[model samples]
Target: MLELLGLSRVGEAVYRSMLANPRLDVGALAAETRLTERQVRTALDELADLALLSPVSGDGALRAVVSPEVGLAALLASAEEEAARKQRQIEQTRAAIAAIAAERSAGRSGNEIRRLDGVEAVRARMAELALTATRECMSMNAGAADRPDSRAASAPLNQQALERGVVIRAVCRESFRNDPETLAHAHWLVGLGGQMRTVPTLPMPMVIVDHRIAILPVNPHEAAEGAIEVDTPGVLAASCALFEHVWATGTPLGDAAAAGDDGCLPQERALLGIVADGHTDEHAARKLGVSLRTVRRMMSDLMERLSAQSRFQAGVNAAKRGWI
Candidate 1:
């Protein structure tokens, strides 16, 4: 119990012995604790440092323990004060860093920015931001450049941050769901507890962490050219607002292919939803995990069920019946 209060084993032994025998000296403590006199002196010095043991009088040979209640509470209070001071220092340092960045860009012309010169640098910046983001990280994938390796590299980051209770929201273009590979990446992200949504289109491949930093590719198709990191309040704030607006309009993936009041299975609803989202038959088939012929057969079945002559009419009829 005293060890929990930061007393070392020897110090605790010495203190306990001293408490039991209020007039015990260092030599008596050593004998009682089965410790050498030198070891007992060391323990006594430790206890004295912690204020658990104080000189009994002007004489240095004997000592007494302050009550555990008072001594331990004092130790805890000191620890808390130290922790609070460190926290304050950390906040101040963060403020200084922000101020420095702001000051550096204050007088620069044409929207101050820093160029992220290479793929490695961009990835490093992303890792840094993800590590620092305490509250949330929002992302958008507007391009179709999600290679297997890139997605794989992001797996651990997404998994760890999600486990850390970070609120992760990602938005991808509707067409991305049609690519089997991209859909696999989405599924991977979802498995990590990330909330993914789809929109008709996205602005670009970008990440906004904590709404304080925004990372964007210079060119959606040519990311190798470089990237940009935006920290200016106006730009960051606008980007944050835009993300929220888009998120509000995006359809959550699980519900993206969700069935309606028509009592359809999720797969059928996924097929209908994919079709309604403007994917071609081949793309829809790929997304639905079926063959082109199967997609055609399903569409024919849907058309027959709705009593429609054409595929478009079938969709219209389904909508009229509140199926899509």
Candidate 2:
């Protein structure tokens, strides 16, 4: 296993032996493993160089395996730092190429529409644009809440943009609020000062930076395949319009509930309506696309608010408040 960290197989065997028998000397390690004394000594020196072993205090020939928690983590961190340095070099080279290509195409394509392949490349470009956004960032997430990882991957960049005072408004499918994981991400983004809303559905996943550039999936579903970025006035306007149309139909997650202000929210009111129509908790949860647990919790909250002992009384109180 240590070979995975660039240790030789012999070195790994010696390290394992030392870990198993901390007081093992070079001769004992060689006798315990399949190596000769000379090979064991060589492996010990190699392991020591990699910080995999520490010399014991009392005996010159005694060494112990460094605890993996410290030794392995340090090695991994060093590797990561080196990889990050190389990535910086690669980014610089890519920037130089992009600059030269842009100069060459300066007069050829007016308000050029660029196609980017792969999700990583597309996300990198989005991050690049976000770095320059001075106004606003608008996004439509289609069914983003369906995928648990979608929000986490972009949360840092989104938060950075928010910190830059860029207004971010995002709309996702209403079912997003039904799932705890999805709701958590939406609330997290809201906590970072980005506005989030939920709608029944959306046309596609898209992002418009400062209303100057819009990035869209070329095949919507297979976003990993590629994306098309639009910057021309006409196309950009149409994309922004699409987002606005969806936005108009969405309910902002943050401002949608005033818990104590009104007795019920729009969704909670719908829940009451479902209950009024004589639906069971399971039926209501199915209708709302939420789990049965969530439906029960909502009912419990409603019952407490109305000072009711039963669902029937909760409905009666809701009716009195015109919530149903």
TM-score of each: 0.52, 0.47
lDDT of 2: 0.79
> Candidate 1, residues 1-324: lDDT per residue as tens digits?
655557898888888887788877767778899999999988878888898876655755566788878987899888788889998997787567557656754667545578899898998778766655668999987654377777877777777678768999998766567678878878877887889987655556788988777897887667787799887889998888888898887778766544446866445655677777778999776554456987888888887878999777877877788887
Q: Could you tell me which 10 consecutive residues in candidate 2 have the lowest summed lDDT?
A: 254-263
Q: How many pairs collide in each candidate, listed in order?
A: 0, 0
Report clash pairs, candidate 1: none
| Clashing pairs in model 2, backbone N/Cα/C closer than 3 A | none
For model 2 the TM-score comes to 0.47
lDDT of 1 at 74: 96
Q: Cα lDDT for residue 267, model 1?
A: 53
C-alpha RMSD of each candidate structure in angstroms: 8.3, 9.5
For all candidates in order, the CA lDDT equals: 0.76, 0.79
